[model samples]
Target: MTLSTQERTGPGDQAATGVVAIEATRLEKSFGNAAVLRGLDMKVRDGEVVAIFGANGAGKTTLLRILATLTRPDHGTVSIYGNDLAREAERARLSLGAVLHSPMLYGDMTVEENLKFFGRMFRVPGLSARVLEIADRMGLTPRLDQRVRELSHGYRKRAALARALLHRPRVLLLDEAETGLDEPARQVLDSVIAEHRAAGHAVVMTTHSVERGIAASDRVLVLAGGRFALDEPSSSVTLTDVTRFYIEPEPGDA
Candidate 1:
């Protein structure tokens, strides 16, 4: 129930046939009369990457936010790394790394200062060394002393990503992470995702770009009408298929 208790039991207690990194069942959310998420169910296994594609207002960000623990669902339950999110929020957070639209950084803080601050918060071991390592990996070593507000959007995003990875979280939740990144920066992001997968972590991301989504994901999920319209292996789907689904209505649409 409590975070400490959940952590004491550890994720190993729940590990079975396949290690499930994220699980959400009967998820629902609404803002006043408008329903955003409707009875969604999802499961992401360790070492897997799942990309969610949806048109605007299709609840893509909303789902990612819920997984990030930024918002609570109106109904249903979520688990992260086998910890019940509702009951073990703190423990669940320890397994999550998120790169949302906003970087969630202190604009006035230097890049190094921001990473140091988050590293301390996450209680990352070898804080100083970890900061340098992540900064270099993210191509932020040169900009370490630059104030976050002074950095370009791409650099700031890299910083945010570094912060997210500071503690080596096992579940990655990326909400439009590649929105403004250039080719190199995007490549860096792709590399990071690959590394995470190689290390047996799980990634769930939302993207509008069909190419990037398909390229980066092992599985593809199309969210339409507040529910999953398509769930299939990325290797079995094509960009044209995704585009057609987005351009046209679902088969039963009136």
Candidate 2:
């Protein structure tokens, strides 16, 4: 589907109209004969939050990477905001904000400089104001002049997140977002997720903390063997259930 730039609505406007923010079907990936994702399928609607839970090497990061258009799937179709990710990568990128394992920030640059750079890259209007807004929201305003390499790990993560939100992306892809966050930082992350959902943006995250993941999401998906072993509404699953699934193999695993 080749949509003209004029036909595209702003990310926020698109979400309010209930558009599909992300769609993936029969996704498959492999590296040197080792299959990481096997026929995975997922859809995240605007105003929804989907959390994917998986163990190490469960292809969680790989899945996020593909969705963010950083990596291509061996077999599958992915669309962001109705644009084909593989074919219209540039267009799709305009609607995406991703925070993967790497902070994706310039270590030598100041926090404010990093945001300004990304804002310019995304062509975000009112770049200075937007950067300050996001920096304040992420609690990085006070340290805006500090070099990223000099900040603590938690602060660096915050800077990364601020950069992602600077353009008000329609879709957010987070990979273990809470990895180095402290309690307060986690609260800020939660608040950001809540705000995005309230504004009709979609979020897809991969996390190991069942409680935290499920708590922030509308749906929970357990990825095992490169496929969804369990997919259900977050309200229907408990922490105990997730723990059990992780601790005890669910029959038929070597």
For 53-148, candidate 1 gives per-residue lDDT tens digits of: 877777889999999999999999999977888899999998999999999999999999999999888889999999999999999999999999
- Clash counts per candidate, in order, are 0, 0
Estimated TM-score for each candidate: 0.90, 0.89
Runs in model 2 deviating more than 4 A are 1-17, 247-254
Question: Hey, what RMSD does candidate 2 come out at?
Answer: 6.4
The superposed Cα distance between candidate 2 and the true structure at residue 1, in angstroms, equals 34
- Those runs of model 1 whose alpha carbons end farther than 4 Å from true positions after fitting are 1-17, 247-254
